[model samples]
Target: YKLIIHTDTLIGLSFSGVHTWLEMYGCEWDDQTGAADAFDQFGYDGEDFVSLDLKELRWISPVQQGIPTVQKWNNDRAYLESDKNYFSTECIEWLQKYVQYGKSSLKKTVSPQVSLLQKSSSSPVTCHATGFYPSGVTISWQKNGQEHHEDVDLGELLPNEDGTFQKTSTITVTLDEWKKNKFSCVVEHQGKTKTENEIRTNPEGSVPIGIIVGALAAVVLLVIIGVAGYMVYQKKKGFKPVSGSDDGSNSSAHTVPQA
Candidate 1:
């Protein structure tokens, strides 16, 4: 009574018992060598039956009417040999059991996304970048050292409903190539390639230190207004000229003597 049928119900009971055992015993064999001779006439001792257990075997009425069509043609040829090796883990567990029995259909195709941001106004440099399968990305802008892609500006590419896609790019430089020179962000996808760079140097403002402290406080206020106008011109040229008393003394006393 050793009935054991499983190797996926032995390919649908080897095609419904080889078309009813080839119209009652006139066989010829083909469907993969008649399913390897009907799993050696049912008692499959093939060493590997992929976890067998045909409901406690013991079937007869033509192997229980070809065991569920040979276990659905051995799970559709082991899901087409695990989708031709997509790093099969048993073809992803038989496509998660053919999408939990609803008999899956399959769909998924995403690959696109990239990013990079840069700014430099004399040393305060900043550059961030990213890119991965973004279909085909390209960005460029440089100065002080050359290479400027037409005023530079590119952004807009956001799609993710599983289709995959993203974008971001910016360029604004100065302060000596944003401090020094070298500034870049180039990416090209679909063929695989990437690049990112930054080199800084410019920084020193405050109106040039307030125009050198307003020209040294206007030359110390013109040397304190020329020493306060030369001390008010020496106190109006050292005033005082009282000469009336010089001869007055003699005239008054000698009026009656020496005329």
Candidate 2:
């Protein structure tokens, strides 16, 4: 058996077109076997305060165990028939109508797009799943079909701009393990079937995209150098050599001085 209770109060004031939000508080309790296993209260009355730590179940803030101030502010008996009311009775009615409309009109299910990516060859790999609805998801890493918890960093589900949700999980691996072992990212969503994304391992001595580009550049540079050297050699070989004397006999030119 389970029992849960939630209380929320919002205090807002508007003048003409401008509005001011003054105070807000939310409280939750679970009357677990009459012991109240989950009793916590948090709010901001011009200053943030919490009655008890939700996890530790102990007082951590200056505020002690007491009913939230918002409750007293909203109590019907606190307001007089002649006095101006702080809360808008019309707004409360509209809020209830909106809740009913959301329950029946909202689109609730959306499939997620799961992807596996790495920042670099040596960096940790991230498994990102995004564009899902309802925000209930489980992301984990598995090696050889066995789930791994150590070295895995799990992130919380965050809402997207388009009313969807996204989450990411990361795992560190040695370069040897990254290349030799098979690792997969498993994503489980409440609305969609389970999904898996396997890591693509590079073969031994295989060049990456960046390394391949560098090799091509090196080859181009070598080709340019070879072409330049060959041009220089051709120019040297094309030079006309001094021919032997026209008489075909080896001779030297001698100039005589006249008296």
Candidate 2 global lDDT: 0.52
**Tens digits of per-residue lDDT for model 1, 26-91:** 111232342211111233323221222222322222444456544653455443332232212222
| Residue 47 Cα positional deviation in candidate 2, in Å, after optimal superposition | 22
> What is the lDDT for 159 in model 1?
34
What lDDT is reached at residue 71 by model 2? Answer: 39
Sliding window of 10 residues with minimal summed lDDT for model 2: 250-259
**lDDT of all the models against the reference?**
0.36, 0.52
Q: After superposition, how far is residue 27 of candidate 2 from its true place, in Å?
A: 20
Best by the TM-score measure = 2
Q: Write the per-residue lDDT of candidate 2 for residues 86-136, one digit (tens) a residue.
A: 112222232344455676646577878887766557877778787787788
TM-score of 1: 0.21
lDDT of 2 at 18: 36
